[model samples]
Target: MNVLVTGGAGYIGAHVVRVLAQHGHTPIILDDLRSASYERIGDFQHEHVALEDTSKVMAVFQKYQPEAIVHLAGSISVRESVQTPEKYWANNLGAGMSLLLACARFPVRIFLFSSSAAVYGNAVETPIRENAILEPTSPYGSSKLAFEHTLHRSAQALGMCSIALRYFNAAGAHTAWGVGEQHDSEEHLIPKVIRALLTAQPVQVYGNDYPTPDGTCIRDYIHVVDLAEAHVLTLENEYLGNQHNFNVGTGEGYSVLEIISAIATRLSVTPQITFLSRRPGDPPRLIADPSALLSHVGWKPVHSSLQEIVNSAVEWELVRC
Candidate 1:
């Protein structure tokens, strides 16, 4: 089966591309190389075109004739989205609409989206489910949720099947593939904490007055490898549906202080920290109830342990330095 993965050169996208190849599938990458580095993808078949370039995107669809599409392209920063909402709407929802239009013209069977847990903003419950109310506080989450609706409607109208994996907090790395979470502007907690520790910089901890135990934000973190594997399993199932939203995470929640402590323990370094007010659009706790994914496809987190997550990230940071 030939699969077309947008943003395939990105952190999680690269891992998905590798996993797909290991499963005996042809993985073709479609990336703009704007926020992603081309070196990450190596020699895999790819097209250096943005989704907004409908002509080129259609050309790639015509050329590869992919049976499945794993859409991972778009803006993904919550804080930035809060600052500049137009960018999020244009890239996340706008460019995605173009891809959906192009997919309708092809024989695409399965469409897998990279959604986020932010959709369920400040959930009243601890472990969030797919059926939870979606009241995204940030433009980033709103954009993702809006595109999900578009995908669902488009899939049903065009007789296509789609799955949106609402990822909680994706951490760790796949250094074996020479790729890890190397964002141009790092915002994810794990990498930021590790970088601060390595350089002896004071890492800022947001919101120490939340309703949590330590008064810090809590989240469900999933390793990139495990997250990529879930995408492969979704394709294997070839689920027949308009759009199925699954929480791709471990059923455990970790606080910000807890995560820092775990990373510090693994790297054997004392982290310098500075507590600050909470950033807007950030939920106090965003833990996922991933039972739906497990029951649906027998998927499990094999390499998502906290120790493994921290160790892999530390190794990647060390190698990167």
Candidate 2:
């Protein structure tokens, strides 16, 4: 099948692109290379274009005639979203609307969206279920939720189906491939810690005043490989409902300090750390239940242990350094 992967040159998108290729599917990647590095895509068939470009996006659609689209493009930072909400709206919701229109015009079948747990905001419970209220705190999350609605309406109008995977932190690297987490600003907790350790800098823990244990935020961290596998399996699901949404995670919550401890244990070195003030829009805890995805598609996270997550990330950081 010809699959169109937006932002295929990105961190998680690249891994999904590789997984699709391994499954004997032709992945036609489309990326603007603004926030993502092109080299990480690792020699896949790709086009240098943003999804908002109707002319170019349509051109690729006309050429490849893809069976499905895995949309992973747009802004993905809570901190940055709080600072620059315009970028998040323009890139996330605005771009998503354009992409959905194109997909509807092209008459694509399945549309798999890489949603985020941020859509749930600071949930009232620990393990957030799919039925949780859609109350996003940050503009980044709002943008994603906005696109989810756009995808739903577009898919319904076009007689197609879509799946939005509202997973949590996508940590860890593909140990075999070595193309793991690479962030320009390093806002993510795992990669941020790795880079700080690699550079011999004091690890800055943001928002240590949250109401969680150790005064740090708690999150459901999923391995990038496992996250990629869920995307692959989404293609095989026979959903009776056209609007299928699921939470993809290990069903485990780990605090920020817990992750640091795991990393410190894996690397066998004490990290120089400094606790900083909380960033706006950061939830105290965002843990995914992941039961819906598990029961529906039998998708399970294989390498999502905090120890393994930190271990694989350390290896990738070492290799990157």
Candidate 3:
């Protein structure tokens, strides 16, 4: 299958592109390189196009004529989204509209969207199910959920088969692929810990007094490779139709302290720590019920263990250093 992966130069998108290539499929990347590095994307064929530009997007779709598309391009910072809702609304929602319009014009078959667990703000249930109420506390989550709603409506009317994988805390990196997470102003916990360890800087622990084990917030951390494989599997299935949503996670939770300890152990270095108050809109615990994905697609997370996730991240950070 010929695939067009938006944001393919990103941390997760690069891994998805590699997974498609490993499965004997050709993937053309469309990335603006606004917050990604081409070095991580390696040797894949790519086009420099912004999702906001419909003409450029249309040209890429026309040129590639991809059988499927994996959309992962968006501004994905919850804190920043709170500060500037317009940016999230414009980029996440507006860019998604442009992409869907281009797809409608070009007539693509499969669309695999990179949705988020943020749609289920402060889950009322232990392991968040697909049926959980979507009350996004941040504009980032709202933007993603809005796009998902549009996708469902479009699929019904346009005969487009789409799948929105609402994933939780994406962490870790490709074990052997050498493509790992690299954000300009790194905000993700795991990456931040790795940077602190490498630079011998203080690891800022946000909201250490949350009501959870070890007095810190807990979240589901899925490996990049595992998440990438889910995308490939969703696209490979010929029976995919209309619109479907799945939570791609390990169905387990790890606390912030646990993650810090794991990173410290893996790197054989103790991290300087400073506790701070909880950030606004941060849920205490957010886990997923991946049973739906397993039953529907036979997809199970492989590298979900905390040790494995931290190990991979430590290795990648060492390489970067």
Candidate 4:
């Protein structure tokens, strides 16, 4: 199968591309290289073009004639989205609409979107399911939710199948391949902590007085490899519904303090700490109820342990340093 992965040169997308390759599928990468590094994608068939450029996107679709498209391109940072909403709307929602328009022209069978738990906002429920209330607090979340809605409606109209994986806190790395999180402006928690420890800087802990057990925000962290594998499973499952939406997570929650402790234990080094108020739009806790995904695809997260997750991240951090 010919698979086209947008943002294939990115952290999670690169891992997904590699996994698709391992599964005997040829992946043609489409990345703008704005936020991603070309070194990560290596020698994969890459097309350096932005999603907003319809001409370029249409050209790639015409050339590759991909059976499936895993769309991962967009503005991802919640904080950044808040600061620059026009940029977010232009990139996330606008680019999504453009891509869909292009895809509709040269109709691809499958489209796997990289959605987020941020769509759920501050959920009233502990483990958020796909049917939960969606009240996104940030522009980034709203953009993703809007894209999902568009994809859902368009898929039905165009006879295209789509899956939007609402994932949370993608951590860790592919240990065997030496590929891991390598974002430039590194906003995620794990990477920030790793860099802090490496540079002997303070590990800034936001909101140490939350209602959680550790007085900090709690999140459902899933390994990037496991997350990538779920994409592959979505492709293989021909019996999947017309438009499937799954929460790609371990159905487990870990506190910010717990994650820091796990990384500290793995590296055998104490991290410098500094507690502060919670950032705007950050929920107290966001955990996933992956029962629907598990029951549907028999998908079980292999690296559910916090120690293992932190260990993989630490190993990659060492190599990166």
Top candidate (lDDT): 1
For model 3, residues 163-232, the per-residue Cα lDDT tens digits are 8999898999875888888888889999999889888999988897888878899999999999999999
Clashing pairs in 1: none
Tell me the TM-score of model 3.
Answer: 0.97
Estimated TM-score for each candidate: 0.98, 0.96, 0.97, 0.97
Q: Estimate every model's Cα lDDT from 0 to 1.
A: 0.91, 0.86, 0.89, 0.88
Which 10-residue span in candidate 3 carries the lowest summed lDDT?
234-243
Alpha-carbon lDDT of model 1: 0.91
What candidate 4 gets wrong by more than 4 Å, as runs, is none
What is the overall TM-score of model 2 with all chains considered together? 0.96
Better of 3 and 4 by lDDT: 3
Q: Positional deviation of 136 in candidate 3, in angstroms?
A: 0.5
**Residue pairs in candidate 4 whose N, alpha carbon or C atoms collide under 3 angstroms:** none
Write candidate 4's Cα lDDT for 1-321 as tens digits.
999999898889989999999999999999999997768777789999999889999999999999899999888889999999989889888887767888789988889999999899999898898999999999999999998999999989889998999989999997678689988788999988978877788899989888898899999999998899999888877888889889999889998888887777767789889998889888999999998888887788897578778888888888864
Least accurate stretch of 10 residues (summed lDDT) in model 4? 260-269
Candidate 2, residue 65: lDDT: 90
Candidate order by decreasing TM-score: 1, 4, 3, 2
